[model samples]
Target: MTVTNTGATPARIRLAYTLPAGLSDAGTGGCAPAGGGEHRCGEWASAPGARFSTLLRVRVDGDAWKRMPLSGSVRVTATAPGAPGVVSDDEGFAVLFPPGPPVPGIRLAADAVSFDISGGSSGLEVRLGNTGRVDAEGRVEVALPAGVTVPTPPSGCTTVSPARTRCALGTLAAGRTARLRLPVTATPEAQRQAPLAGAVLGQLDPRSGPTRQVQMSFRITSAAALATPVASPPAPTGSQGVLAAEAPAVSDGGGGGSVRRTAILLIVISTLLVVFALALATTSLRRRMTAPVAGPSAAPTE
Candidate 1:
């Protein structure tokens, strides 16, 4: 009964529908403006059991398309040969929106997030911008379905519950922003080839209370190549040397061995000097015995 432009950017929606019999009138087509409201159009009927097509085209505004993902329900009605009409399918259609800005109350800028299954935690980082009238305190939570695992959220993120990870973003005033890191640790079974579904939720308080929230869902896939983590070259820790917590084997890589060798040599030289001193004392004792005293015996005989 009504047609409208429901996108942030200008868009054209073409809707074609069939009409009943004996009610078709002239000038039966028109356009719906952005943020569509009700509109009356010319009658659409001509004869008994007649079918007609009603086509509507509209240009949507650019800014409107960026507010939210566009979704709508279509209602189709059928009328009897000459009796009242009955409504048909009210199927809904949801249009896709890109992952970046212009969405209400969200700021997805300058956020670094990665997912890795190589023996460590992997998760997402999000930056939320507050544009509402009130300040916001919130976090992001992610869950993987059966057979999938999240190793850990990024640093500074904590797992508050078994399957829920929460990052507290204290308070952000209007036009200001806050950061949230969501880390997850997964079981090995979950690390195996699996698909991951994650969500980011915004809450307004530290204590348990009603939460004003926004969420987005996405998927992560792990391939065979991702079974093992590729080791990254260690970053320079920017220290004078490696800390004690690190490999101490190379503490004195060059000088330590030489110091041990010199110590062994000194021990061997000291032992040889003691042996030579003992030998000299033994030779002196033999020489004194060979030079026995005969002068004392001659003086006694006189």
Candidate 2:
């Protein structure tokens, strides 16, 4: 509140104010109750063209503010030297309680995730942050899609059922973050394009009200899509020749064996015929030798 003396002389001023119910003065700023239940600041002198100001702090009742409207009025009286006592009309004002700080806002870092169904157990870290100005206490409710299994619930979380997991978030301070490691196994039947939903249901401290619900959702992507592609290894040098050399020799069925046996038998028979021919020639020669002398003499006499 301010009081100004615009006259040519110094002035004595008296200021008074009234607070509506559900509000109380902290009794500072030299304010006291005058007669007739009006709070006042005693007479103070203000020089010509000078202003006097004071601050008044008030305490508000939360319950009352929540229940009803608030309004009040103020009056000022000033007496200048050699001037008619100046009186100001009752100035009325309305106190509007601006909306209170909202309940804590729950935020998820990522709204979607991909898990490899064929890959063994996989996990997702659900990071939750409080975006509101107040500390929050609540449970984080997580619902997994069908065919998605939670092998182990995160610490401080309970398995409500096969598809639902709930974890106690205790008290989350404003601007702080918490993490829930949701270990889950994706069955082969787990399908792509599934939905994962999560909610933080709780209350803001120092206020009794309905549980606030902050919901977030995630899209499920196939883990195979997120997998890294493995490159094929290079082939060894000279592999074709090495493979051929190491291969076992194959022969046609019984025909190959018969052909080989026939070749050996023909070779043995040719060798025996040569030996018999040589022996017969030798024997004939010996017989000729024994009869040759008598034959030669008879031919000469003729």
RMSD of each: 28.9, 40.8
Looking at model 2, residue 149 earns an lDDT score of 60
What are the lDDT figures for the candidates, one per model?
Answer: 0.42, 0.55
Estimate, for each residue in 48-163, the C-alpha lDDT of model 2 and write its tens digit.
56776767777777654443234445666655554443533233334443323343455554334455546553465666676666777756666665666677886788888887
Per-residue lDDT value at 137 in model 1: 69
Q: lDDT tens string, model 1, 157-261?
A: 676656555665667776777765555445554434233344444544423324455555444444322443221113212111111111122445675787888
Query: Candidate 1: what lDDT?
Result: 0.42
| Candidate 2, position 198, lDDT | 26
Show model 1 residue runs off by greater than 4 Å: 1-103, 106-117, 147-160, 205-211, 223-302
Residue 61 of candidate 2: its Cα lDDT?
77
Alpha-carbon lDDT of model 2: 0.55
Off by over 4 Å in 2: 1-105, 109-111, 191-210, 224-302
